[model samples]
Each structure stands twice: as structure tokens, then as C-alpha cells.
Target: MTILVEKPVLALEPKDVSNKDDSEKEMAAKNGFFAPEINSFGNSFRDYNAESARQSTVEEFYRLQHINQTYNFVKRMRAEYAKLNRMEMGIWECCELLNEVVDDSDPDLDEPQIMHLLQTAEAIRKDYPDEDWLHLTALIHDLGKVLLLPQFGGLPQWAVVGDTFPLGCAFDDSIVHNKVAKQNGTTLPPAALFIIRFHSFYPLHTAGAYKHLLNDEDAKSLNWLHIFNKYDLYSKSKDKIDIEKVKPYYMSLIEKYFPAKLKW
Candidate 1:
């Protein structure tokens, strides 16, 4: 005999969704926080083939990063940078420093780095109000780009920014900032660390590369990273976020998770 069992409505039922969601959605629409289908340059986001002034620079950056980021090179960079001796400053201070840095690797927006950080953070905050850690993650995700500044050793754009990847046999490209956060004593959870570490890892998260290396824990963390990446990439635009208005809120989060001053 064949039997069929009744299925429960496991997905979020309409009644389960609170009015807060509707209100948040309305606010997002009113403020134009919705993710755009096209990037600021009138092309799909991360389209390396799109012809523009930035296309050549981005392509060159990838070429250099792939050729130079070998296993021994990454190991040396990691060990040398792990000392955290660059400088002692608070998280907010680091945000201020990013105003001087520009990411030539990015093709979409040419605005100051701080604006991008705020835009990403505010977007995440509006959508996921309760996840303060996520909001903070968005804000400080690229602060590691400060490595491009003179005081931070004035590293080249190829070393400091762009899509990072593992350097060994199955190499792909991404960023390298998790060490700064971890060695600096961040109390954020593993998921937060994973997102911060691999947000620029488009190969693993976007193209499904490097799957063989992930554990069950990394799989669970990938879910959060996927959500974080949406804001990280799509939030790029010419729109300017009010720094003074959002400063107080992000400061509270920094205090909650990191010490007043961190090494490097």
C-alpha cells in the first residue's frame, strides 16, 4: 500500500511575517534602497567584458594578482602582516582614513571609499534591522583597503583590493583582511568573520569554485556570506550616504564588538 503524508507549511507563512517587514520594505522603496538590476555604469555589475576606462585597469589587476599571489608569497605576507604593528587606532578612525584611499579595481563607482562603506552598511541595516553585526560587517568590510595608505605600508592596489583567492593548486582570487580583524580582537561570530574574510571571494561564493575545501560549518556560513555579498556589490552607486547621520549608530556597534583601538 502507498501512503501520502500531509506536509506542513514550513516556509514563512503570511501570518508569521510581522508588519515590521512591510514597513521596512516600504521604507526601502521610499528611500530607493532596493538593489538595482544594472550598475551605475549602465551595465551588469561585475561585467569584466564591458568596455570602459576601468575595464583595462581591472583586467590588468587580475592578471598581476593571479601571477604574483603564489603559495609561498601568501604565506610570507600572512606571517609578516600577522604582527599587527602597523598602527593603533579605533575602528571609527580607520573609517576616516579610508577617505584618502581609492579602489582602482572597482569598475562601478568612483566615489570615496567611505561612501561605499556607509551605503553598504545602511542598505543591510534597512533590510536586516536586528542583525547589528551584519550592519557593522558591511561598514568595515573594506576598511582593510587602508593598506593602500602611506602609513599602512602603501601597498599596491593589486595586493590590497580586488577579488582574492587561495594561492595553491586550485587557485581563485579574493581579498585578504580577516587577519586584521581577528588579530585585532574582534568579538564578532564566525559567520561575520567568514563574510568579512571572503566577501570579495567571488569565485567561491558567486561561481561555485573551491567547494571541495569547505567544511559543513563553512557551508552554513556561506548562507550569511551570500546575503552579505548582495549588499557589498549591488549597493555601489553614485548616491552619497550622510556620514554624520549614520556615524553614531555604527560607533555603537564598533564599541560592542572591538576594542577602542586595534593594532593595524
Candidate 2:
């Protein structure tokens, strides 16, 4: 059965920071806020060049992820993991777990995942101090990658991380390897969920390719998701942040939004 879907015309223009609140502007100045750029390696960020040291491994990771991330596999994974029976720990503990891990799929930075989380959250906080929810959202967006740990199902990097896309629809060209799904069992706010699920769905947000699948609410959330992609994707750097200094602030946020201990 073939059905025709009309893509909505969206005026998703970029927001001007020049007119932002004075406090935010001041914060940006103090923090050296600027648009994200390519890494020091002289390659474009996420460039999978065959000659690059990280490219072969990154490509292989995506190759496996693309081949195995099928619809039935997704369903099976959701059923297995949704029980959330793995461990009971505070959110900061989960963040600490990532210190032992690095993302093999990433070509830009090779630091531990917790460093990336802190870099992303700190970058966003500098530009939008009032948006505490957004700051928290950046901190924990990749917590799902803990699936790589032996205690939490020990899933392969292919199954746990990489660019994401919608599964039942066409694989848009903007998404890397272009395959995916939404999640369930999350108690996060709609906006946070939008960022968590679709942050990897670059085809829709970056290329404007999945407008036909979106309704009014999806469109509204898309705005914030766009704002978040900047920090999530491009905030990696060699600059180190002192974890002890910032840990208390993020712990407070976790306590506010999440219970003292979560199921996973």
C-alpha cells in the first residue's frame, strides 16, 4: 500500500545571538563562547578519510552498526534492556562509569566519555545560563552508552553509539550510515527526550529531510534539538575541566530531576 506524504515547509531559520539576554552575552564573553569547529588534527570533524589513523576503525564500527541495527534487533534489544534491572546508582555514578570508556566510533576526540559530557554541558551553560534543563540534558544525553559496560548488558559499540535515524521511514542522506528508532520507558521531559532520541538523527534536524513525519509538537521540540546538536557534536576539545569542581553542580541537577538512585 503506497501512501503519499506531503513535507511541511518549515521556517527553521537560525536564531541570532546578538539580541540574546545581557547576562547570557556576558557569560559567553567570559567563557570564550564561539561556534564549534573542526579539531586540531586538520581534518574536518568526523571525517572518515581512508588515510587517517582513526578512519578505518570508525568506518568498520559504522559498517557493523549499519548491518546489525535491523528492526527486529531493535525490538529485541528494547525488550531485553527495558527491564532496567542492571544496577541502582546515582546519575553521577553513571557518569563516572564512562571515565573508563572512550567512543571508538568518534574520529574527532579520543578522550573518556565523561570528559565529552562535561565539555558539552559546560559549553552550553556558558551560552544559556538560565536554561538549567538544557544544561542537564547535555550532561546525561549519552548515558545510554553505558550499555557498553559488562554490568549493563555489555553491548558492542555498534549497538550502543553512533549517529541515529528513524527506523520505519526512509534513511535520509544526512545521517551517517542512516539507520534507527525512538525510545520508551524514559521519564524525562518531552524536550529532553527529543534531544536524547534525535540528537543522532542528523538527517531530520541537519538536512531537513524528515519533515513529513513531524507534527506540531515535534516541530517545536526540533528547535531545541537543533540548539543542542551544537554542543553534543562539536564541543569536544583537549582543554580539561576539573571534575571535582563541577561535580557538585551537576549532582545537584541530577538530584533535582532524577531520584537518588535510578534503575540503570
Candidate 3:
């Protein structure tokens, strides 16, 4: 029943994926508009709980995410994206690039990439007539997933989406596939019940998850993340959003929600 069926969706760029060093690729991504901290979280949440599947679920997250996302890594990201060089292109192009692939790892979605965005935006527009920013939220919250692209920062599916949690603090118990806590070293005592949940973004709702860490724009966009994530995570179906018909409606919504010009 996985909607993200294994379609021949990903298209290799004409230039081919470069084997350039990680640091060089990171720098190139900055020049192209990739954001920071998005890669900080990997598919940590996607790992199975344990070797036996019954011997107390333990996720292989700490073994990887801890090393990939170190203190220095966060600081390096901050320094890189502060200049925002990576995104010198049009936003539409980024969306199109992202649209080239589907999140096959996701169980509930079977739609095209663009259709998924439309579904999320349309679902919100149905409820809140006046919340213009919500339309923008639905459209952009998953922009971080563009990291799947090489130019944007070729991140794995596990990194881009899953139940999101806080970094500096401890993990929470509300995680959907809640076995990730069983890694050899994954302890829950000190940061008891700090687990991150689905649709968590607003500092208001998430008990200041990223409030202190995020800048104003990221914080403000937290609303859109909150509003859109409802559908991003839940709005999937065997059905799909009609691309031709839904495009104009979404454009209007985006116009209403976002300013005429955005940085990336």
C-alpha cells in the first residue's frame, strides 16, 4: 500500500553526479541555494528498532546521525548558508528539479512530486479562507527535500522527511514508528519524553523545539510548516491531485500567501 511506489522517477542530471569531495559539494550547494541544518537530520527515524525486532526496538540513528550532524557540522552549516549563495536560480526551477523524484520511502503517497505539493496546499485552502500564508506554507515546507538533488545537496530520503525532533534536547516518545530508541547507546532518562512528533514545528506547539535555535524567517515560516505538514504527512491517497486543473488554483494560493519576491 505504499504510495511512493518504486517508479522510474529520479532523472540523472546531464552532468552526472560528481564525486567531488564532500566539502566541495557542500560549497557548491551553498552557491546554488541549499539551506543549512536541513541535512542535519538523516533517516535516523526510519531504522528498525532492533536485530530481533522484538528485543526492545533500537534504531541505528545515533550510529549515523550523531556523527553526520556534529556540533562542528551545525556551525559549518551556519557559516555556509549565512551568505545564501547556492540559490541564485529561480524558485520554480528548484521545484521542478524536486518534482523529478518521488519519495518512494514514504508509505502513504503515490502521487507525482508536484501533485503532492498541490494536495497539501489545496487541503489547507479548503479550511482557512483568510490564512494566506498557509498556501505558501503548503508549497514550501518540503523545499528542504530538494537536498535530494546534487546541486542542492544530495541527501538521502531518511534525512529529508520523517517525524522531526529537536537536536540539542532529548528525543520524544510520540515518534510514529517508535522503536528508534533502542540503539545500543540511545538512552531516554536524562531527556525523558523529549521525542519529536509528526507535524511538529511551531515553537508554540512543540514546546520551543527549535525556537531558540532558529532565526526569525525560519521561525515565522514555522506556521506554514505547521499548516502544510498536516497534509504532507496525512493527505496522501491512492488518488492524486489533477495536475492541470490544480496548477492555477495553487498559483493563486501561492500568490496570496507569499510576497512577489522571495530570496530562494
Number of backbone collisions per candidate, in order?
A: 8, 0, 17
Residue by residue across 76-139, what tens digits does model 3's lDDT show?
7566645565555443445556667676444344345666666666665555444444454565
Question: In candidate 2, where is summed lDDT lowest over 10 consecutive residues?
Answer: 179-188
Q: Report the C-alpha lDDT of model 2 over 66-118, residue by residue, as the tens digit.
A: 78888888999989888877878888999999998889888887889999999
Query: Candidate 1: where is the Cα deviation over 4 Å?
Result: 1-28, 171-181
**TM-score per candidate, in order?**
0.84, 0.84, 0.54
Residue clash pairs of candidate 1: 163-173, 163-174, 164-173, 164-174, 164-175, 165-172, 165-173, 165-174
Residue 22 of model 3 has an lDDT of 75
Instruction: Estimate every model's Cα lDDT from 0 to 1.
Output: 0.78, 0.78, 0.46
- The 10 consecutive residues of candidate 3 with the worst lDDT sum are 186-195
Q: Candidate 2: list runs displaced more than 4 Å.
A: 1-15, 18-32, 177-188
TM-score of 2: 0.84
Scored by lDDT, model 3 comes in at 0.46
Candidate 1, TM-score vs. the true structure?
0.84
